[model samples]
Target: MESGKLLKAIIESAIDGIITIDNRGRVESLNPAALKLFGYKLEEVIGRNISVLMPEPDKSSHDGYLHRYQSTGEKRIIGKGREVRGLRKDGSTFPFRLAVSEVQYDDRVIYTGFIHDLSKEKEAEQRLKEYAAELEELVNERTKSLKKMLHALSEAKEEVSLSLLKEKELNQMKSRFVSMASHEFRTPLSSIQLSSVLIEKYAEPFDNPHIKKHVSKIKNAVGNLTTILNDFLSLERLEAGKVEPAFTPFDIVKLSEEVTEEMQMIAKEDQNIIYQHTGIESMVNLDQNLLRNCMINLISNATKYSGEHTFIEFNTEVTDTQCIVTIRDNGIGIPESDQKNLFQAFFRAHNTGNIPGTGLGLNIVQRYAGLMGGELHFESKINEGAIFTLSFKR
Candidate 1:
């Protein structure tokens, strides 16, 4: 009697839900845990078919399974754990793990089932599946955005390449036009100059001021046009990389004197260009043609900008280490702001007013100096004077 009470106490105190059924599958007893798990009282479930606590197909098949097992002694759900659903008192269902074991009593048989709830684990698994689907969708959206950006960059690169090709063709055509026009205009310009000189010579005997003035104007206009054509031709050749200096042994003193004499005829009224050689050595190896052109350009600038009776200083020096030439003039000096761009092609100083110039002389002179491996630098002050120095290493 004591042993029977102890066994009952142990079963009632168990944490897991426990239930016992007769060989015929009728619920005979249940622990307190089993009663609370199904939301039923012991009196309500006692003597009822065990299928009352089962759900769906299991509820309907329990009786046949029990009969088959009793007759054939086949163990299908016996001595093993099965995941199954239990029907609650409110007609709702929940998942649980059920373990059944057949117990042999004195003359009859009974099945005891232990039940562990699994509702929480199943809910957590469903949540994980939903999270994985959301992450995949985000990855797909980012990939699509990246592909669109790459496509736009490719299109932009192609457009830039096309623009560069068109610009190259345009530059080549412009160079060709300049070369042809300069050569074509030269013949007419020479004829105009010659005719003006002849007109001046013939009209001097008549002493007509109008005839002399008009001839002078014609000569000046023709000279200006010739300068423009020459500037354009020089720039075209430089851009095509065709201008190279030819070095030779020449008398510096002779070249300086010759350049001054040639340029003196074109100077502004009464403007004097003084030529001097300060160096002892008279002969030096250099590009004679290029040097003559540079000296002529500088003197012309000085003569053009200076007022009547102003003096332009031209000096040359040849030392053991270097050869130097300097030209200084009192003229409408370049502004401090304009000095920086003095050697840029087609860029005239802002201070120049109504002056006949192509603004390409200094640029060409600088380039010519560079081809001879020389340096050109200058100094100027507004309304005062300007000085340019050209030097070559020995």
Candidate 2:
């Protein structure tokens, strides 16, 4: 191929745009890439000044810039590349990199320019900047939301603490009132009980059945009141931390027999308390008063709940390692639903219909057993039977 033809072919196929201008800044030649970059035909741009392809002040001032550089030999955009705008044939503008070179052939001087389109690169950079801004905004929003949630949780925790303190104060006030009322009522109730018994003895001369019956009713009523007051007193004392175990070596068998005898007198017609002892050792170190109270409470419950002719089994076994006492009854047993709350203060079984009770006996007994380093446990099913066991470690 000829050198000139080869040069022309290279200019036509070049990816970057190429343009040539004379010393007067008139367009001398434009490669195919340059023509496409300016959206102009080759023939149309041949004789025009290269400034026609520029926008705004650059279009008007480009001729003076070239003139000044030629005269003063000062370099601005002549040798080094610079970012500039190009105006298309449709009057739209775009960014490009423009590099100019001065060429001298004999006496003629020309400027050659190379252009690189910068549209895609600038668009991508803009998009990345937008994405970075959006990411920063999302992070800030999440952090603010988390801080609000933490503040709300802190307020809720403080409210819960205050409510708990108020509840504790109310419970203390209730305990004080219960203790005072129970203590004051016991004296008058005891007096009523003694007067009723003495009246029954002194009025025997009248021998009237009606007088005897009414006197007996007064005595029974007073007895029930006294029992209720005693339960209140015991509970108050326990809550006040005044009740402590006094351990001593004593005969558990004898204690069980005595409780059984006392409870039998109050049992229903034909009802009996059957007492039995196992294990050779009856002498165990325990809080005798607390143990006796537990026995009396269990036997009393059995006497009240069991029908006529039913027998309450009060069995005890003292071993070298432990002492076990179990009171079992075949009576209206505790309901499955009520059993969970059985040891709670003032809780009563639903099956106890019309029975006179303060509902504190079992709770008191359980507490007494705990003071004496013993455990109280029970098993029951509705209308089947119930067994209460007390165990003490030696």
Candidate 3:
């Protein structure tokens, strides 16, 4: 009696739902917690089967499970917690975590169950899951926006780089054009002035031959000026995309002769231009006007900077598909420090100090060479000489 009373007190005081069943699986006891967990009272469930608290199929087949356990001694729900449904007094059902334990007392077998309510825990777990989903969504959104911003930044940088490159190219072209125009214009202006002065001073006092010579000089100077202006206009046309290369068969030797003859008087007293043609005398397709200007610029430069009696050598060699021309001069050669800026506009060599020049000769020569599908190459040694080579494809 004392032991039964002690067990009753322990069952009623349990924090978890406590229930006990007899050896025949009948409900023997029900605790206060069990009453609250299942919405049943001791008077209602104590004499009924333990399956009264279960719903549906379990309520019908639980006796068989107990019979099998007794026969084989297998334990399924005993000493383990599992999720199951329970019945309430109102005929409604609620989910729970159920644990059952078996105890033996005085040849009687008893089962005790502890039940835990799951609604509150399930609600808490669902809330945590919802928070996690929201966090993942926020991270994906931020990542997408950051990636878009990075791509835009990359495109902006590329545009800035391209713009800067174009600006640099324009500046270089402007410098070259300005230098060539100044030099080319100055040459003709000087020639025209000198010729006019000679004609004015000597035409009345000198013989007919002298007057004729003066007039010829003025005409030649005017013609040269016209050529220079035409070359400048051609450059403008090329830059404006209006001029295309005219390829036609022509003799490079003939072009060299004409240029040297035109510049003969300008050559120093000690310097004379010599043209040597080597290899086959075959005609190559090229821009005649552009090639002529390139040769003229090179030859004129040689004449301008060379000593009084130095030899200005013009040599040409033709291969199967190309023609190479080299103009060499033994004069005050360019300094090493100024070699890099040779093709820059208005950048005259230090050696040409006080020399009458506009400093666009090399720049124009380089541009003309490029226009003719050729390249201009040079070599210079201070006080030794300079060699300029123009190579064109056949």
Best by lDDT: 1
Per-residue accuracy of model 3 over 1-394 as CA lDDT, tens digit each: 9998997788789877877788678988877888987887679887899888888878888899888878898765744489888888788887888877778878878876778777776665455445434433443453355345435533543454468775556545544544565564556455555645554454443244544554555544444544444444554555566656788888877877788787776675757888888886757788888777778778877877787867899888889977998999987899999999998744688878766554566777787778778998999999888999999887
**TM-scores for all candidates?**
0.57, 0.56, 0.46
Between candidates 1 and 2, the lDDT winner = 1
Rank order by TM-score, top first?
A: 1, 2, 3
Clashes of each: 0, 0, 4
The global C-alpha lDDT for each of the candidates, from Candidate 1 onward, is 0.81, 0.80, 0.71
lDDT of 3: 0.71
Stretches off by above 4 angstroms in model 1 are 1-170
Check candidate 1 and list the clashing pairs: none
lDDT of 3 at 296: 78
Overall local distance difference test of candidate 1: 0.81
